[model samples]
Target: MPRMLDVSDEVRAEIGDEEAARLLAGESAPGSYDCTSCRTPGDSAQERTSTVLFIGDETAVLAFAHATCLPSQVVQVTEEQLQGAVRAIGGTGAESPQQQYQSPQHPQQQYEAVQQTPQEPQPQAANLVPEQAVLGVTSGLVLLQGELHPALVVEPTAPVARPGSLGSGDDFLPLLIEQGFMPLTELAGVPPVLHGWSVLLAAGQLHAVLQPSPNGGRPVAWWQAHQPLQVTDGWRAAANKHQQVLMFAAPVGSIGRQPREDLLRDALDKAAANGKLVASALPLAGI
Candidate 1:
């Protein structure tokens, strides 16, 4: 029996036409599988299913999702993220520094905060940030129009200068705007989805923020964590609920280290009012 699968040209290119044909002929495709986007059971024989290929540095994993939740495409990730996902899927008791940790009592608060300090600088030649500065990421649930949404706030520790430019001036928000991030005066509604950009959450933890590559093959890491940061279960739930993450950016010192969600919102609003914030809704990886 033929399956109701939508194998995209991009996905087919990665998996090859022959393998894609096998999937279309129902020779290798699963009859029933959980949607990678929503984690809900989907029957490919009855519903329009999408083939999502997650390509990593060393390996690749082909996953499935419902057409409505996510389209058929390829999502690039790091080798560590792929390994972590394998562990999560296998229920291995292995523990590492990047292991996912959750505390029931402090469900909303991150277990480890020190690991979030800025260190990793990706694509050094591109000059993402100043040589002395680092990006600081904070996770929280943002309230927009009386509803909660998963959010990641990005701020640099120092001013971000333009690539190959002399003199020190912050081009943080402007650079993001060029990359499709929208400026906001108020949090009226969800920001528009920025294509070619996505959040990396592997093993149920915050991993990295991916951006369109300079040379254009796979999306490169715009902001990568020194170690995977554990987010609140509530934050993860909201991300899965909406299938997107609200990403906001501000210049250095615009939105400082906010200790609480309420504080984070207050800082965000202040940044927006001061014209220091830009945002966009990025779909979770696997789309």
Candidate 2:
């Protein structure tokens, strides 16, 4: 039987005509899948489906989404991120240092993990402060130039400090720029895919989302939780299958806490409108 499918040029290029033809023929496609964008159920045989391809540094994965949620496109990712996604999909444990200490068996262990600081006080860099600031992040999908793009809206709860200049007003955007985050003057196209940063989704939940470091060392978690944030199963499935995630950041007061996804989206729009948004798209690697 023929199925309703739409394969984008980017996806077709990645998967080649032969594989794409098989998918369109339903010979190498799943009958039903979770929509990559909205995490809703979609049936390729019954309704229009889009072929979304996730291309990592080392491999590529084909995924399906509803035409309404996300159009067919090729998402670029990194090899490490792809491996982590595979592990998550296969139910293999790839625990982070904090995760290892956050075992449910020991409440004390979890407490310690939360309080744990880096061994030896690391010296402050340019655009860095000695004191750590907790950043609040809200993530949602946004339509840009007629394309659905995953975006994260970030804001620090308090004014960020600069080294030896405590309370000198929020230097958050400058700090981010110093760390390689680019401010968005326009949203003409997706920002250049930033490297060494990713949003971690595992076990049908939103885990730690990361930010790039100044030293070009390991990326640091920008948002982590005492307990992982619960999310729709379809969201986690899409994260694992796509193996790529996009992140956006802004300064203090650029965006605020919203109780619902709709409100969060509005906040993102406001930030973008104010010209206070910085964005990056990275592959899903280990936390």
Candidate 3:
């Protein structure tokens, strides 16, 4: 039986005409599978489904999702990120009939990344440890306008200075504001989309936050997880439903790692009340 799957041209190009035809002809596609975006059961033969191609440096995984949840498209990812996905995905990810790829399963690590850049340039001795300049990232679902939205809270572990500024005050929120993130007075509604910025999630895990490169070739990682950080299934479901993720950034100590969602929300509210929160919504990338 031919599967009712939607494969975009870009994805088709990457997979080649022969492979694409095989998929369209119901040769290798699955009839029943879990939706990559929402993590719910979806039937490709009964309803419209999207074929999402996640391509890494050396491997590619084709995952299925409801067309309503996600469109058929090609998603670019790093090999490490892809392997991370494969580890989490297990048998849920597929590519072609002749090939089944799996990475050496590794223990899942769950920690968000924080970005720390000095506000001003300073002349210092070379050899600096990268870990000292890090940002702390937290993932939780936020309730807004009667809907729950997946959000990422970012803060530096220490005062963040501009890349080459001489002055030395925390510039985390200010720098984000300059980049088009709007300051939040309250969390009553969703933040506006931050163009050219995206949050990458593969296999329902948080991978990295990407920002537009100043040089304008490809976007660069603003904050990347040391390893793929595991997120709650609720967070992933919310992210897939909304097709975006809200990102809130504050200065150091504004929002710490809260052990629970309620605590996280409370911290966000406190940050807003104290006028220390900035937020924007970025389109969700990958699965």
Candidate 4:
């Protein structure tokens, strides 16, 4: 029996026509699988399924998603991220797929949980070790040069120490400046878009910001969520309307933990004036 599967042109090109035809004929396609995007059960024999290709540095994995939840497309991911996904699919991760997808009773809740944290715990701080720098993201619309643009303000919760110089009072901005992030004198113009880096937004919510892999094949999530972060309706509307956002990153001491949105903007202004800010504009791509 034939299945209702969407073998996109890109997927076909990558997997070749013969393999795609085999999948359509049910020789290779799984009867039921979890939606790659939303983590819900999907039946290819009953409803249309989108063939999603995840390409890593040296390997490519094919996954399936419901046509309604996610359109078929090729997603470039770091090898590690792809391996994690493979582990989840193979039920080798700490939590089995059933357990991971079992909670989130509501569809909306499930959608929000799509960007679950990796099975490995983040390195923790001990009594002798300082806490890792955690970047806090605040989203708002900033009026720049008489134009309103959606922007994300990132501030480290604590001072970030340079490698081998812990607690040396070194600011984080200079470290980022050594990278490609540009110092913004003013928000008069949008920052340059960094290649292979993008903000992930889908179904009107922010998921994560991704950076390219060191091996240079694909991008991986730099920051992801156990639970999706909430944003204002206005901010979400802005993201959906413009389909992009500006990301500003600064060192911990640069912003000093703003207490309110107005205060946060003030801190950003100060950082710009002090030449301690780096920024980039990113398009909203799906995770």
| Best prediction by lDDT | 3
Global lDDT scores for all candidate models: 0.71, 0.56, 0.73, 0.63
Candidate 2 weakest ten by summed lDDT:
111-120
Q: Candidate 4 residues 196-241, lDDT tens each?
A: 6777653234556777766666676767643345456667556655
RMSD of each: 11.0, 13.1, 9.8, 9.1
> What pairs collide in candidate 2?
81-284
TM-score of 3: 0.79
Q: Write the per-residue lDDT of candidate 2 for residues 93-114, one digit (tens) a residue.
A: 4332211122222223211111
Top-scoring candidate (TM-score): 3
Superposed Cα deviation of residue 273, candidate 2 (Å): 3.0
Where does candidate 3 clash, by residue pair?
114-135, 115-135, 118-161, 118-162, 119-161, 119-162, 120-164, 120-165, 121-164, 121-165
Full ranking by TM-score: 3, 1, 4, 2
Question: Residue 281 error for model 2, in Å?
Answer: 0.9
RMSD of 1: 11.0
